[model samples]
Target: MRLEIRMSDLTVPEARDKRNSLASRTDVLDKVGVLATLPGDMHTTTEMVASFYGVDVELVRYHVKANREELDTDGYRVLTRSVFESEFGSLSNLDPRARTIALFPRRAVLRVGMLLRDSSVARRVRDYLLDSEQRIQSMNVEPLTGLEYALRLVDAEKRVLEAQARAEMGEKFKRAIEGGDGLTLREFHKKYFSAITETAFMEHLYSKGYLINQIGKGAVRTEGPKAGTRRDGTQHRHPTYKGKRFFYLHGGGIHGGKRREGTRVRPGHWELELRDQLAAEGLAANENTAGLFVIEGGNSKGLA
Candidate 1:
C-alpha cells in the first residue's frame, strides 16, 4: 500500500489571512530574536524613532538595525533604554534626558514559529502562500469567488516549493567554505571576502585576533604601499610579522569606507611575538600570515 501525503484545502478567509500572515511572519522572522514586534512602516517607523529621540531618522535606523538581535532577545520595551545607553554610551548626549526615558509599546504582534524556522520548510510555505495572494490581487477581477481564491493559493504553494529548492542549492558556497579541501587565495577570496571592503575585512580580522595594528610606516615603505591610504598619509597596512608579509586586511566598512573610532590598535606584543611564532611553525610562507590564519587558525582548510 502506498501512503499519500496531501495538504488539506483552506477556506477563503483562512487562505487570505494565511497569505498576509506569511509576508508579515517572514519579515518578523528575518529579524527574530532581534525585534520584539513588527514596525508599523519601515520608513515611518524610523522617523517615529528619530522624533522620539530628537535625532536623525537615518541614525536611529542605523542604530536599530545594527542592534536588532540584541533588541529582540531583550524585549524592546524592557530594553529600549539599555540599548540606547549601550549604543551611544550615555543618555547625557540627548538634550532632554526625559525624551529618551520613554519605552516602546510591548504589544507587538509576532509569531515566534515564523522567526525560528526561517530556513526550514515553513518559510517556503509562507512565501508561496503570499505569492499566490499577490497574484490573486493582480487579477483585477472584482470580488474573487471563494473557489478561485483557494485555487490560486494552491498554485502559489507549488511555486514557493520550486523557489525554495532553488534557494537550498544556492547555499553551496557556504558548504564549500566549511569543507576541508585546499583552496587557493584567489578562490577563497572569491568565495568569501571579495564582497567585503578592505577596512571591514581588517576589522573582522582584528576582532578575531588574526590582525592587529595598522602596518607601521617603516613596514609599508619596505613592503610596497598598499592600494589605499589612511588619514595620516600612511598606506593602509596588512598583517605582517618579523618582516614577513601575511594576509592583506582591507580597511574600510563592509559597504564602503566610514570613520570607525575606538578600534583597538594592535598591541606591540602581538606583532613581535605572535608573528614570529607563526613564522617558526612554517605557517607564514611568503609573508602570507593572513592565509596561514585562515588555513590553520581559521580552520578554513576544514572545508572539503
Candidate 2:
C-alpha cells in the first residue's frame, strides 16, 4: 500500500497552512537535510537558500517578491538601520555600502522551501511537509534548561542593551546635527556614518554631482593667494547649485591661528536629499524609512 499527497503546489491555503505548522520543526528539517544556518543566529541568507535549492539567487528573490506577504508574516525581515551593522557586519563578502540585508529565520526558510516550484529539493520538501502533516503538528521542540537557558537569557539581555545603545547613539547624533550651523561633512559622517571614511563619502558625492571640483576648472580666484591664476588647481571642493541648498559656506575658522574656509551641512536636509539622490543611483532605503524619506527603488545594497 502507498500513500501520496496530490497537493504538488504549496501556495494553496491548506498546504501553506500545513507548511507554517511544520516550519518550526527543526528535527524534520535535519531529517530532510536542508541547508544549515548561521552558527549563532540560526538565520540563512538569500544566497545560501538559493544554493541549497539549486536555483539562481534571482529565482529565490522572485519567490520572495511574489510571496512577500506570507513570508514576512512567517519570519522574513530586511535588516537596515544600525542594527544590521551591530549584528551581522562581520559576515563574509558583505558589501560595505549595503544598507539593507535580507534575513530569513528558520521558519521563513521552510516557507520558502515549500513555495519554490522549480527546484527538485523544494518539491521533495513540500511532499514531506504534506505527507507528515500530522506528525509535524504533534512534534514537540525540546525546551531549554539549566545552563543553556541561563545563557539564552543572557544573550537576550545583551541584545536589549545593544538595541538601547543604538537608539542612544542615534539620538545623540540627531541632537548634535540639529545644533547651530550643523556639522562639517567630515564631522557629520564621523558622528553618524563612522563606518564610511570621510574620503569615501566625499568621493561618492563628487562622482554623483552633489559636489564639483573647484580648481583646474573655469572661474579664477578673486582674492587670497594666486588670485590671477586662471586655473588655481588647488583641489578646492564646491557644491553644485543643485547641491548647494544642503550646505552653507562656513566662514573661515581659526586653525593653528590661521583661518580657513569650509562648508557645513544641514543634517536633516542632507540626510533626506542624499537618500533621494542614491535612489536615483539605483540604491534604496529600508521600507520603514522609505515612507519617511526615500523616493524610489526596492532592493537596496548601498550606503543609506
lDDT of 2 by residue, 47-82 (tens): 778877888989999889988887887778988736
lDDT of 1 by residue, 155-268 (tens): 999999998888875455434432332333343333334564545544555455444454543332333355343233232333322112233333334444554322222222
TM-score for each model? 0.26, 0.40
Off by over 4 Å in 1: 1-135, 140-168, 175-296, 302-304
Which residue pairs clash in candidate 2?
none
The number of clashing residue pairs in model 1 is: 22
- When summed lDDT is taken over every stretch of 10 residues in candidate 1, the lowest stretch is 2-11
Error of 1 at 8 (Å): 32
Per model, how many backbone clashes are there? 22, 0
Residue 225 error for model 1, in Å? 21
